[model samples]
Target chain A: MKYEILEHTADLKIKAYGKSLEELFMNAARGLMSVMYEEESSKEGKEVSDVVLETSGPDKEALLVNWLSDILLESDTRNVYCFDFSIHTINEQKISSTMKCIKSVAKEDVKAITYHGLTIKKHNGKLEATILVDV
Target chain B: MFSKEILQKVQKNIWEIPKSYREDMCVPARVFASERMLDDITTDRSLEQLVNVSTLPGIQEFAISMPDIHEGYGFPIGGVAALSVEDGVISPGGVGYDINCGVRLLKSKKTVKDIESSIVDLANQVQRDTPSGVGRGGELVLSQDEMDELLEGGVPWIIKKGYGLEGDEEFLEQGGRFDEADSSLITDHAKKRGRDQVGTLGAGNHFVEVQKVHEVLDDEIAQTFGLFKDQIVVMIHTGSRGLGHQVCTDYLRVMVQAMAKYDITLPDRELASVPFLSKEGQEYFKAMNAAANFGFCNRQVLTHLVRGSWKQIIDKKEDLSILYDVGHNMAKRETHDGKEVVVHRKGATRAFGPGHPEIPKQYQSVGQPVIIPGSMGTFSYVLAGTNESMKQSFGSTCHGAGRRMSRKKAKKVIDYNKLKQELDEYHVVARAGSARGLVEEAPGAYKDIDDVVNVVQETGIAKKVVKLKPLVVVKG
Candidate 1:
């Protein structure tokens, strides 16, 4: 799994090369938490309450947006800070994921998704998604 | 971002570039900003969208953007354009997803002096009476027929149902009624979202604040607005709620087909639009108007609740009246330059000057009142429209304190616990759907509203009437 920050803005483009799409989806969830608290240390003593989300899209870009939006909205609405996530992205049009939010007290709020530099591409050997989450 | 080649100074606070700036641009891109505000013009793709707005068919004059303009999905948040009704284009993105999300001002006879001791109770009462949070429904559940009447009748429908006040219809913009709405055009999904959401505060930058008239800038206009120093006022900032969101989501797909049918080519797919007078465009206009009417009904019903709470607390029975209600996000059909034009103002407020047939007879002598609300923990302003706005910017003005930082950044740095503590210390009661939401909307995340207000005042787009400070805020 590898990620690169896009130039000129706070956005990330990630590539997770795995034999199966499940591994790719889980890594993407980890990528999302890294943008905020970036760890599980504060969630050490907390019991896990898994929040599952199911989303589908006609295109990968829209799919990625719906997936991230679901997670972000759930985290904000529930007042749960997330550090660990496990996701299952079906090659079909949908992605199913279980998000675990850690109970931590710091960080910023996401305004909404911006269309600025949004891209999702399927390469020869890897699936890559680029998203700009408003800080 | 604007290339140095594309921009040239027209005068103070005004920048202009030719229609040839972009290949698809059909008119010049014009923006208003001071030397300071223009320094960060390249911060986002705002100028790009501003120029793209010029490409719409039948766009009259130049594409105009307010000083607080920032990049948004389809149109820049503060962008405005006027398209000819007969040949122009109507785009959903041009009005924004959160349609009719606007500000409503209500003034009470009970001053801050009278409510100081019971401020916390009042705030709590407001929070309890109004529902907050995402997917939060309300007490009133309307049937399909009632929903139709609400859409066509706007506030009058709510008023007739005993959830409105006397003189409210007159004081509100358009008497809280717009004849352009045809509820038959609204989709079942849109109606479903609004069925139980009236009087509820939807999440993200929406709130009901009990404010005190802190400063009277223009006394004559303040008097006309029935505001006095120390008087208590309530400002409800919200719109059609879930219904509006569904309306936009439903249309985005419809517009995709509309774009193909109309054969309109644009560089940005999000700006998918149909020509004015087309079946698709007229349907959207009608649907948008219906959502705007729903917004009026939402505010009207909320006002009745606030009035009841005010009456409960104050010893003396006094009138709490609606000062004005204006839609900051919308697209309207109006006559400009002797031609009927479709005006799309996304994240911008309409600032029609005096003597317009649209304004109520009472305010006809004082011009339209434009309510510009700041975020929670900040001062909101009431400004009156100016003739200069009608002549230069199609009777439009800046809406509020524009976002300088994203919501994600706000939640990251601003501590939610600390924010609640600080507000409590100041005796400003705060309530929210989520604690994190409170931090996400911290005043630090936005531009200096005073600066934004000053530009409008100096530019004569709108002049300040009275400054208001929040005593209690119910945030959702």
Candidate 2:
């Protein structure tokens, strides 16, 4: 279980788990940065930015909603809060990654990254997905 | 997963579900609600997302929702459909990621007994001149030719860059510009996330309350819009922040790859679609009317910063006018029953009755005000629009008090200090950026804005004329 938080009523559902497909797109960017910094827990000593991204969608659920909407638009236009995702090349359309961001500060406002009940599943031999953010 | 025993009662407080309960419906789906709010709207996949919005394509006479229906994310939050601009389809998840998330009311000449001792310093100076949480950013930035003259001169180009006032663009709505907005069809990352989020207020359940006029159910339509009773008003709620959530995440990823070059098969890839005269649906309907003219210039620059916090805390010539500015996540291009469709209204509310020739001739004999807003210590409304809501709801209604619990069950049974001691036992004067976004906007997590405006004034779709309550709320 690389991710879990599901229970939406007005957006912010998660499910992520994987065994490849670049670890379900890096646990769906660690379940959209753990439900967007769920009440901000310390991410200590700031200034750590490594970025590098790329997107393409045609499949794999629009390449996982253009890879978590380009890590939520590089964490809301570079205000910064992304997490540890490092998928180096994915398929079913496109992806390339490298992450680790921080200048954090987001106690809610993950407003877009929804394909409602998106899918990316498999059973027994594990793999999962269930995203939806729009908070 | 469809049940409410396939609803039927299609009249008094309406309800239907037909279209053979599936097999890719193309019609039947209504739902005004009340039969005890249809057991809290069939306990929620919003009637299977209004039966997948009656299977899209050219939807017309049905596919409605408005009893403040819930379960949003691809049209369910108080939905409404209407399609057919010759041939339908235009889903930016049917206008959800805050494209024109709206509400605006204002109207102050002092009351609540002349501002009961300046209600908590006018809600802490209107939450310090309107800069709210989550990616805040305000103090009016712009530039990029003033965000393309505010994405094509909306709010009369922010009232000629002096923010606003002079007849606040005739009580808003379309007066706040929508000349098929086209700031070069948006993007420069939606103008760098809406260059400094014009007059910000960007969190969930956005707000900026401070009301009063508690009750007057139509004294000649609340004196034709200048409302009365204990007077003092001001509502706000927000929209188009982060440039209408990145122009709906850049056209729902260019309509999910132009829905395979317009073959448009959808059972929810978040309702992605094309053809409203494709070219990627007329460039996402002119970039969603330039993100709805940056949501009417981000609530007319937060009504010019809540009229400079009611003239810096209740005096220096406090006027605060503009009595209407609705938008409830739009789509517009109406005409109804005389054809030319395209309505949409996600989280509905248009309500254009009483001599509707686009209202405002001093409210053309009393209509088009319809504000709604409740939850955050309940009671809020203003209602008007009718001709029986343009023959039963194409002139839509209902926009708030909708969420029936679940910001994770309202933060697992609210208790942010007992919901701030029940909003200080209703003397209110809250203010937050997050006390868990104020216990996930708890007013018992909504639905009961007087039973959703008494099912839109007992089904005429809208009429109630006043009742407001809160005395300063402000959130983000």
Most DockQ-accurate candidate: 2
> Which pairs, if any, clash in model 2?
none
Tens digits of per-residue lDDT for model 2 on B116-216?
A: 98789889888988898888898778779888877887888788778887778888888988888788878787788779988788888889898899889
Taking the tens digit of each residue's C-alpha lDDT, what string does model 1 give over A1-135?
555433222223333343345655565555655554445446567876777888775555555655665665555445466645666556546887776765543343343443335565567777665665544
The true-versus-predicted C-alpha distance at residue B28 of model 1, in Å, is 1.5
A-chain TM-score of every model: 0.75, 0.32
Q: Which stretches of candidate 1 lie over 4 Å from their true place?
A: A1-118, A129-135, B1-6, B421-427
Model 2: how large is the Cα RMSD against the reference? 20.9
Residue-level error in angstroms, candidate 1, position B106: 0.3
